[model samples]
Target: MNKNIITLEYRISKLLRYGVMLAGALMFVGWMSMLDFTQNPLLAFHDYREVTFVHSIGYAWRDKVWGLLTAYAGLILLISLPLSRVLMTAILFWRQKERLLSGIAFFVFAALIISFSLGIEL
Candidate 1:
């Protein structure tokens, strides 16, 4: 394998691993806090209801709800991991001068961004 490809793969693996770890940690804290307050996470779920993560984040910020904010931030990061991977792959393909692959990656990235922005479930 090419050195560049190996390096890219290593970087991507690290990104995924760390991203998941961080998200899990954030969720753990969030759930712990919820449990502390309501004595049950599920029972308190409705207290932080929102139409979307974006809205939840805004509400959390305004209300200074640390638990809700951490949870939503983690969710947003988790949800965006695939998009980040696609973007990184696109950049790699571009650097490697693989125009077709790069273009396809870019197209997929754009599609994901559009669907995510429009709140389209797939």
Candidate 2:
């Protein structure tokens, strides 16, 4: 019975981890689409300029798209972050066999929770 409980918890934790990663990916993609990185660095800018072929393409789409990408990106990140933590906690509870993974997941989830809660966007 005790083993079964642990297994159940472990499975929940795994699901949570997967959820957080998915949320993070979605948020990252959304957050990235917001900026005209071709023109300005929203986050980091040094004397060095950041340029990408992708930004060039995005530039063309920018006027036509009418900020849809930025809107969607913001929405997804805002929604996914909290959801990610919930999922992470669930996964942590579910995965017991893999101690290393569980530990890593816990730390990652914890950090994500703190960072996201603080609204520290990359």
Candidate 3:
């Protein structure tokens, strides 16, 4: 493997690990916040039963639920990490003059974008 490829691999691994840890931390904060108000950990589950991916962020923001907002932010970050990796791969492939791999990486990135957009309900 090229040195650049090895470095990219290490960076991508770190990105994934940090993304997961951040998401988990945000969720834990949200859970703890709910516990503060409800006095029971299980009660926190009820608050999010009706939450949906598209609306939760806005709702959390509007409601001023710091925990929920942070949790949603973490989720968004988690989702974007892979997209970032795909983008990085494309860039690295392009720099390496590997046109075919670069094109494929770009195609995958585009597909991910389209799928994410389609998932949102109007």
lDDT of each: 0.83, 0.60, 0.81
- Give the runs in model 2 whose Cα sits over 4 Å from its true position: 43-122
lDDT of 3 by residue, 17-43 (tens): 988899878877776664564465566
TM-score of each: 0.82, 0.36, 0.78
Q: List the candidate numbers ranked by lDDT, top first.
A: 1, 3, 2
TM-score of 3: 0.78
lDDT of 3 at 10: 95
lDDT, candidate 2, 1-122, per-residue tens = 47777776587677666756766666566556655757755444446655453574476476665344544454565566555655555565555465667667777777766876677333
Worst 10 residues of 1 by lDDT: 33-42
- What is the descending TM-score order? 1, 3, 2
Tell me the deviation in Å of residue 65 in model 2: 7.2
lDDT of 2: 0.60
Please give the range of 10 consecutive residues that has the lowest summed lDDT in model 3. Answer: 34-43
